[model samples]
Target chain A: MAQKTYAGVTVELTDEGYLVDKNQWNKEMAVEIAQENDITLTAKHFAVIEFLRDKVEKGETLTIRAIGKSGIVDIKGFYELFPGAPLKVATKISGLSKPVSCV
Target chain B: MTEKEEYPLKKVCIICAKGNLEDVYAACVMANGAVMEGIETKVFFTFFGLDAITKKQMNHLHTATVGNPAMRMPNGWAFPSVLGMLPGVEAGVSSIMKKQMEALDIPTIPEFLEMITAGGGELYACKLATDMFKLKKEDLSDEVKDIITVGEFYGLCGGQGTQIIFT
Candidate 1:
């Protein structure tokens, strides 16, 4: 599959889902990917991505839908579009050691 | 651990029936879950279920009386349906139910409606049921996106990869 770049994130779309180079992925990149895929980017989406990225930075593993449910995009859509990608909520990934609350 | 792959369901339709406190709470929880899961969600309220969506009556939604197996009273006591006919009985039941739900961290029907809408779920009023009950649009919650017939609702549901769920 040909690799695509969105906001410096190297992404490749596959039958399973989009694969990204974690080194090149960031919250801005995720938002850009959603936009490219025609998914509406709301404040909630960004919040989740930010949370997920923080977990990764902290060496914590997480899932995307575990993030808060306020986003406009369906959790199903998020998983389908970003398979294997961790979701964050307010700087804390679900499986991460450190817990950060956005409330 | 690796993240589990999630296959997204396209849509969900909720059918709400009027009952006691538990029934109302169940409807709200299901609807909220659908919206959270990213399915396009719609809720259809009929009969007593309509009270949960009514502007003024929503906060005062009550428990059903008589022949309902789900109802329970203190000390294994059961109330008769005849008592339900008395004025303020419904209100009393509703208030108690509300208090219980609040303790359980469940939001009220109006709050649930707001959560669903804020999460991008659609809200509709049943046309035939509304007309049958002499309910006007003004009587419904302000969040209602539209008043639609069952056929129209089905039309919206008619697409590739959509699922209709009755709660």
Candidate 2:
């Protein structure tokens, strides 16, 4: 039961720093989280985020290889964008839950 | 709140020492889950676990039907050991498992490794194990980041709050 404040908004977070309530997420929060992770948000990053959100909304599993095959970015490109643990970092900034299929 | 309050774990190192389909997937699943939780994750494959990373055996991994007390049939009953001894039973069981995984949309072994690696997880092959098995770097799947010694593997886990998982 921890909280993170961003751009005048505060939200609850899990111990892992994931937003506790998806509804509490906003674009600014995404930006803030990305900055905290040493990532600068770009259209390409947003594209991956949007793809993640869309997939989550539709109840589809997300996998790195799936993203690699999606043509938005290849596996190597994903690493370049997120830099570290791409799926975890991307999902965090996307304001989405951690993907269960990541493993 | 403190940083530790926000993120309890710093890292996780998962070791895959067995090669059977069940054991290898168990390690893969756990390693992937750790990274999904935002934990820095590294997986070290050693011994028979090399089979999982080896190009020729990765996709064709077979389930260990013999002496597997936890295995169950389609009816939720204990799998018959006698049936396991019959010809083609191993392949039959392995195919069934593959089919079930496919039905669930789970990726194959190589794809799974690709997904894990692309997600920022690290994959390493054991130097001793590779040598023992006579596997060259070219024989492994592309997902393997490097062949590292056991000492080097431990060095990667040298971080505060890092957990080591062996399967």
Candidate 3:
């Protein structure tokens, strides 16, 4: 697993996808991740992250395509390859009935 | 060195008239540099200059072909007014110029206005010119601080440290 530390959060790229520590997901974390990944985090990216985090909280398996279209990832093709495993889209990973745009 | 010795000119006001893309971009680049230099800046848009500030028309600003001295076309060729009349030609030229400027990190006029305002500069519309052109406040971008008469502009330009420049 290749890993990087961003703003004290451990982000590891696994065979499954990106694994972000639950204790370290926030606006600062998002900015750090974007910066580390060389992606420009625009206002639209923030909107999508909030939306995806809500979905993760509700226990829905977020489609990689959906995540890409949501505007968070500047490179969608890489994310599109991982469609199976319950990808950890949010830091506070929990099981729920559905996905909400935010907490 | 003391603050006074480190920096001198306090304010600069620029007047822009409608012209070719190079001229318009040159005007914007000058204003941006002045703002970066910590000088208070004002850009007053009048007549065809309004195209550089209006939202819908801003992206299509072009360089003057007939009498402009700084214009150069592809392969050392000069662009003729007849070719400029073709549909989308002006926009193509504008886009090319914008790409070149972006490569050089010079902000577009709208972006330049945002930079200026963020840096404590002011942007205004020429009231008389606006009325004569039948343009309303809504015709301009939301960043414009206000519309003022030429006399009012002069009032803002007053003081020994202020320099007014026409582009």
Candidate 4:
């Protein structure tokens, strides 16, 4: 685990950089992390991020196709916004743990 | 860290060349898994694998019970090869597998494709295979973005950390 400070709040992260205690997350931490990954938060990004957070709360499996059909953002728009790794980056910014389903 | 370990995996291209229900779903599951991990993912349907992407045939895909080493009876017994050759045995086995997957909450093939594509994963059909099978573009699921050649498949995987997995 690694420790990082955001907005004067110290938090734990996994070796892969996912948040350890999701309760420690806030919009400010999300913004900092997004900035670290070269993304600037926008209304569109928030829409997807908030949806991901909600899905986590409900214990739902998030898939690319599911997100695409969510009517939140189409698949093309998702890739355009997140670029390199949409699901990973979006979930990280949303303050979720690293996905265990993908192998 | 060594140079070899420094470069992170950036993309994954999975080539599905078999049409068997289990084989095609295995490719779909992996491709979907890659996308779930936030890796750029692409699945190429080639040869008989095209059956998975073809609209008319995708849902009708069947498990290959003949000589399948992994098949097992529900009673925790080994499924015999001789019995597997019975006329209805293949369908029975396929239905059993599908039921097991459903019990585990795994998505169906079309649903899996929907999930993968929604998550920003790319789907493609092989140009040669499509032509050889005389399949028109309309024959494939709308998720298939394009029909491309094997060289083009490798081209998409040209990035330093890109992985090409054949199934």
Candidate 5:
């Protein structure tokens, strides 16, 4: 892990750029991280990010199916939001660990 | 001196030839995994595997309890193959397997296909198998892009960093 600044707040991040401490996250830092992934945070993107952060906080496993059923967005929109690797990209921007689930 | 360069996986093509629930899921899990990684993925279901794409049968597949040497009881005792012939045993085993998969968030066969396609992956059925089974286009799940010959399947598989897997 390494220290980096996002939106003027310096935080710890993994080599892959995921946050080391989710508690250090904030909306402004998330905006910078999302920009790194070429995403411009919109209301819809924030919806999915908040959903993911909430699930992680509750110690629930993340799955594409769960997000699709989250009512915030369907699976397709989720992919469009994070394109390529939805769960991995979304979690990284949301200041969570890289997802390890195969599903 | 030259430096070695890495070639990340670019595409994956998977084929499921058996209808067993385990075999079908193996193919799907691999294909979906690739899709989730943003790699191009294509899956072909043939022969008994056609059941995986069969609209009515996709969600109700069963594994082979009789011939599978690895079959075991929940308590880890060796399962007697002869008992596999008993009424309701296979169905019971299959349901248990499905439940275990659900706990891991593995999607149903239909849902797996949906997830794959939703990520821009492709699914196909084998032409010969569909003909032998007397199945029409509508008989397969809508997620299937087409019923294609093995030759046609090969046509879609050649490229750098592409792998073809058979189950």
Candidate 6:
């Protein structure tokens, strides 16, 4: 396991930098993680993150198509919110494991 | 030994030459996958592959039930070639195939094109094939950026870490 400190809080992470313990994640760390990817999180981004966390908690699969249908954002808006591999970047900062979806 | 620097794929140029349901889906999946990975993606459709973007045909694609070596009955038995020749068998089997993919969260061909382009992937039709079939731009899905020549398509594939895939 890898470790990093964001906002004075050290947390376990995967080698790829996703949080190993979702509970260890906080809003401040989310902002720091987004910064690592050069993104500035906004209310819209947080809403998507909340949706992803809920979806994962329910033991559902993560897919771009599902997320597009999330009603929080359309496919294009989702891409714009988290550019450059939206799913990967979104999940990483959302305290979720890296998504294993192709579409 | 020192750790090697990672060199990720920077771009993908996919070419689809067939129009079968599986063929078109394969191209769509790969192109969309590349786009989701943040790689620059360009899809070129030629010959029957144009059916994937053709407005009247894109969503109505069918996989081959006859002469498909991997085909099997739902019970896991080898599909009989004779049964495949019956009317509606191909269509029935193709819909089943589509359902299977759908259950895996794969999008329909039209929706896949929308997702790909929404992520900044570019789609094009081959000029030679479009002309041979007498197809015009309006015949293709609105998601298609243009009908381009092979030379022009090749020009877009230029860049380091770019792969040209023919499926």
Q: Where is model 2 chain B poorest over a 10-residue stretch in terms of lDDT?
A: B1-10
Taking all chains together, each candidate's TM-score versus the true structure is 0.59, 0.78, 0.56, 0.79, 0.97, 0.98
B52-151: candidate 5 lDDT, tens digit per residue: 9998899899988898899999999989999998988999999999999888888999999999999999999999999999998999999999999999
Model 2 chain A weakest lDDT span, ten residues long: A94-103
In candidate 6, stretches whose alpha carbon ends up further than 4 angstroms from where it belongs are none
Query: What does candidate 6 score in Cα RMSD to the true structure?
Result: 1.0
- lDDT digits (tens) for residues A1-103 of candidate 2: 7987976788888877888787788888899999999999999988988888888888888877568777899877887899757888898888787666643
Expressed as tens digits, the lDDT of each residue in B1-167 for candidate 6 is: 99999878999999999999989989999999999999999999999999999999987899888898899998999998999999999999898888999899989999999999999999999999999999999999999999999999999999888899999
The per-model DockQ list reads: 0.07, 0.38, 0.02, 0.33, 0.81, 0.91
Pairs that clash in candidate 3: A55-A99, A58-A96, A59-A96, B20-B62, B20-B63, B20-B64, B21-B62, B21-B63
lDDT of 2 by residue, B15-43 (tens): 99998998888988887666555578899
Interface RMSD in Å per candidate, to 1 decimal?
8.2, 3.2, 19.8, 3.9, 0.7, 0.7
Estimate, for each residue in B32-147, the C-alpha lDDT of model 1 and write its tens digit. 66665556778878777887788978876666665656555655677777777688876777687678766654667787787677666778888988998899999999888888
For TM-score, the strongest prediction is 6
> What's the C-alpha lDDT at position A64 in model 6?
92
Question: Who is ahead in TM-score, 1 or 3?
Answer: 1
lDDT of 3: 0.61
Alpha carbon lDDT at B147, candidate 6:
91
Weakest 10 consecutive residues of candidate 4 chain A by summed lDDT: A94-103
- lDDT minimum window of 10 residues, candidate 1 chain A: A94-103
DockQ of 2: 0.38
> Each candidate: what lDDT?
0.62, 0.85, 0.61, 0.84, 0.93, 0.93
> Model 4, B1-167: lDDT tens per residue?
65664777789999999999989988988897777667889999999999999999888888866687877888878888999899998888888888887766677888888778877789999999999999988989998999999898888887778999999
| Cα lDDT of model 3 by residue, A1-103, tens digit | 6676656866664443354344345576666655544455566555556666676667655543345445555222322222111133322222112222210
| lDDT accuracy of residue B107 in candidate 1 | 67
